[model samples]
Target: MIPSVPTLHSERFRLRPLVRDDARALFPTLGDPQQCLYLTRPAFGSEEELWGWLAEPGWNGRTWIAEDGEGEVVARVVAVPTDDPEVEEIGYITCAHRQGEGIARECTAALLAYLLGEEGKREVIAEVDAENIASIRLLDRLGFHRSALHIAFEETHKGVCDVAIYTLSRER
Candidate 1:
């Protein structure tokens, strides 16, 4: 059975499923232009936009939010299925001011452990803009291998660009 979204405890934060109430705490990081520079989609322009995004269905996967003890949102992670149920796609977004602080790594590790260990996923996938070096490095640190780059995968801060796909298998 699929497990219910559970609160995960990391050394510095508590990770829980993303909820609508998190909109205010997450906007600064999610809307920062510098942070969204290589994102596939444009930076959120308003709280309304962020809310719309947070409210959208996850395409059948889980979305987690990492918060400090004071309840400030520090990072976000998501693992959603692609066309194949055994393969899941993961996403991470750290607040702008919190970048370079290892928040993404902490949150993603927690999410992956649950998804691959308890959930029985065969692989975890991530598609990032080719110019997104930060994300590429994070995936590498997490043991993901480069799969392929799709031509003109999506429009981004650099205009239409190739998307690099990375994957990590359970056996690895």
Candidate 2:
């Protein structure tokens, strides 16, 4: 089981576990149809629903909220372990206003370090929509290699989408 992380730091951002109150700040980006298409998660029905999910307890992973120096949430990241014990899958989403600012890259680096160093993780995986060029590129930049593809893993507002799997090991 992945333990709850207190708070992680990067050059320009701080990441902490998502909480019930974050719903309002996160609604605009996470609820946007354009942004929700790539994420497997559906747009929340209400802040109450978001609170429920936020407060739900699970052993798989923890979702983190990235905040700037002023403590305003700027993005979100998740690190969930697959059935494989030593392998963990990670996903990241940047707030609409913060896209293309390398926030994903920076936050992911911190996650990797914590996972590999502090969490004793051996491998990290990422699943992205086949058509999400930017995410594919981001995974590549982070040293993840394409590993497999899942056909029709989920349906999105755009249509049924294929899931592209990528992997990164502790050593390279």
Candidate 3:
């Protein structure tokens, strides 16, 4: 069965379903070479790819478009079930222009609450590049404890960078 759609809200942002039409808004962030630093894929080439991934079935994942009070899409937060049913990894990215505004933190906290409080998920995990101090700090504020640091499995210029693993349990 398909997973239920996820919609979460915070004091300053709302997380809603990511749609194909968001490509135009997403391109600015996704297409930036600097923004793609820690990401697995370089850059999305077309809207079709975005739509196709969002529409895939049997995938236990949901991507939310993070919108500000003005209803402008500023970033995206995603949670996807891993091989272990009790664990899901989370990821988020905000527009470079909107950095330092607490957008990612707000959305991440909201998403965590929605998953653990509403959806009954057990654990939420995140892997961050060691150099991405901003992301690491955000995760820390959300109660994600560091579990490990390892070389990333994905290849990039930073081939063997330190990865900080974080986890939040449902019991918390």
Candidate 4:
């Protein structure tokens, strides 16, 4: 199993674990259809459902909540282990109201460092919906290059969608 999640830090945000109370605070954005459009799962129907997901104990990865100075959750990040010991897959979701504020970039950069340094992962990859231009741009800014190998399409709750893979190596 992955080691206990640790609190990470950035210039303007603190990345830590989610609390029960955070489910309520994040429901608005996480439950919104627009925010879940590119996700494999559909928008959560209620705060309780989102809470249940957060409460799951057998998570195969590490997760963190990016909180601003005021302690509000601005975004969530997850890094899942893959078959290759040197690699991990990552994902992030930003609160709707907090988009375009550089929170994702800063917090995710910290996450990348932790994964590559402390976690001993040599490479990190992110899989995003092909149509998610914003996320694709973010991955690019983070120095993740689009991998030639990608899913042509996958049938998910959102119907068939093209998926793209991006990767960042520790040496870079």
Candidate 5:
């Protein structure tokens, strides 16, 4: 069964479950090619396409949409269980216009607390493209250390790319 997603909050944001209307609210950012540069998927061509993708049913993870004080959707966060029951993988996409405002970092920090505390996850990991410096720095700021395992190359829509794995353990 899909686990229930609880609303999460940070000093400047409130994270809640994603809804259909979010497709419209997030399109300008999620559909931008520049914003999707280091993402696994390419930019969406239209709001309908993004909705279809967002509404697709195969994800076995918890997803949340982060909203700011004005009720604007500023980011999207997700936590997916890994092969090891004690570990969970986390990811986020910040709205293009809201980049550099600490939205992803703040919301993701809240997620880490939930996963490692309430959810009893021993570790939280994030697999990021090696070339994505911003994300690497964010992970560092969040106290995540680079894992020893290095993915030399992985083929994606962006072609062959190196992936860096970062992890934060509950004891850390």
Candidate 6:
């Protein structure tokens, strides 16, 4: 059986499935260094990779494209299931031109609400680069308290770097 798609909306943005048609709008944002500072990989070389990543199978995870009121995609948000069914990892990135507009925060909050409230997900985890203060602050505002710091969880494009893990539980 196919997993259900989630369409989440916030006051200023709409979070919908990351479709093939969004490649043109998404590539620029994913390719921008400033927008992907905390990401594990550098800019995606092709739209095919982006599409493939979104279409991959997972029971408790999904990717969403954030669009503004005028229907322009400004960012991407994702909730990926881990080995444990009760835990889901969340991450997001906004286009360079759209930073500081609260788009990431809005999209992330919507995703958290959908996962915890409707999907019954127990916990949401996020691994952010230690230097990415903006994302750290955003996660905190969304009720994700820091659970670990300066941990080497994965080998990223920037070599071995410290990351901070934050978690928001359903009980909170």
Query: Quick one: best TM-score, which candidate?
Result: 5
- Report the C-alpha displacement of residue 139, candidate 3, in angstroms: 0.8
Candidates' lDDT values, in order?
Answer: 0.84, 0.85, 0.80, 0.89, 0.91, 0.82
What tens digits encode model 2's per-residue C-alpha lDDT throughout 1-172? 3567679999999999877778888778766777777766777777777677666765467888999999888888888878877888898888888898999999998888898888888999998999999999999998999999999887876779999999999988
Query: Clashing residue pairs in candidate 5, if any?
Result: none
Write candidate 4's Cα lDDT for 79-172 as tens digits.
9899999999999988899999988889899999999999889999998899899999999999999985456578878788889989999998
Superposed model 3: Cα runs more than 4 Å off:
45-59
Which residue pairs of candidate 6 clash? none
What is candidate 1's CA lDDT for residue 50? 90
Better of 1 and 3 by lDDT: 1
Q: Which candidate do you rate higher for lDDT, 3 or 6?
A: 6
Candidate 1 has a TM-score of 0.90
- CA-only RMSD, every prediction: 2.0, 1.8, 2.2, 1.2, 1.1, 2.2
Candidate 3, pairs of clashing residues: none
- For lDDT, candidate 2 versus 6, the one ahead is 2
Rate residue 147 of model 4 by lDDT. Answer: 88
lDDT of residue 60 for candidate 6: 54
Ranking by lDDT: 5, 4, 2, 1, 6, 3
Count residue pairs with overlapping backbones in model 3. Answer: 0
Candidate 3 weakest ten by summed lDDT: 151-160
TM-score of each: 0.90, 0.91, 0.87, 0.95, 0.96, 0.88
Q: lDDT of model 2 at residue 100?
A: 88
lDDT of 3 by residue, 101-121 (tens): 988888888888888877788
Residue 138 alpha-carbon offset, candidate 3, angstroms: 0.8
State how far residue 27 of model 1 sits from its true place (Å). 1.0
TM-score of 6: 0.88
Candidate 1: deviation at residue 22, Å? 1.2
Supply every candidate's count of residue pairs whose N, Cα or C atoms clash at under 3 angstroms: 0, 0, 0, 0, 0, 0
